[model samples]
Target: MSETNDSLAEEKELLKSVENAPASKKISTYAKLSGPGWLQGAITLGGGSLGGSLYLGIIGGTELLWLQPLMMIFGILMLSVIGYVTLSTGKKPFQAINEHINPVLGWGWLIAAMLANLVWAMPQFSL
Candidate 1:
């Protein structure tokens, strides 16, 4: 009975500590927890996004201010779907796409990603 009481006291203390933690600390903790996914997201935001944003701003000015956020929401949704599919199927994204979707679409996506990487790298290489 004493050991049970002690274990209960320890559990309550742990819960209290978690409850008292600052909101910002909790957010930062979660960010650290998702470090690998965050890094992948950062890497995904490359020259293609920069170029797209530049063109959108140039062509539409403030009139298209909603476009960027809307696109980001859509991108996030698509990424979530991909993540879910990969997790549920235990398959790589490309393999899942090729096997479950269309093989041509998967190959085309791979080629497009490769071409975009080369295009973004060209100016850096020249410099």
Candidate 2:
């Protein structure tokens, strides 16, 4: 939509202007533009994160403190790889999924994805 495009353009301009600003100004600008940061935080540190942390704490005590940081590093690396692939390939990933990595495997992947979505949506029913 034009509205979304306009806002994105405006945000890009604001980011460009603040690129070399003072640290405080840059931080404030970033904070202002990061409208979805809270949503991302919620997703990242939601119920699953709490449960995992509690389970790890009980099992490994302080010995597993490094695990989180290590996992975060790997996650970042994987995200970066995915981003690079997206940038390099104009093709969409789901297209391949729909086409079938051969029909049988494609159906398997599609079924798994559907089941994952079903499980993911289960918590929302409690609301």
Best by lDDT: 1
Q: Which ten contiguous residues of candidate 1 have the minimum total lDDT?
A: 118-127
* Segments in model 1 whose C-alpha atoms lie over 4 Å from true places: 1-21, 46-52, 115-127
Q: Which pairs in model 1 have colliding backbones?
A: none
TM-score of 2: 0.54
TM-score, prediction 1: 0.58
- Cα lDDT of model 1 overall? 0.74
lDDT of 1 by residue, 9-117 (tens): 9767755666769888667655754648977675667666677678889999999989989977986886787788776676998899888878997798789768866
Name the Cα RMSD for model 2: 5.3
In TM-score terms, which candidate is top?
Answer: 1
Clashes of 1: 0
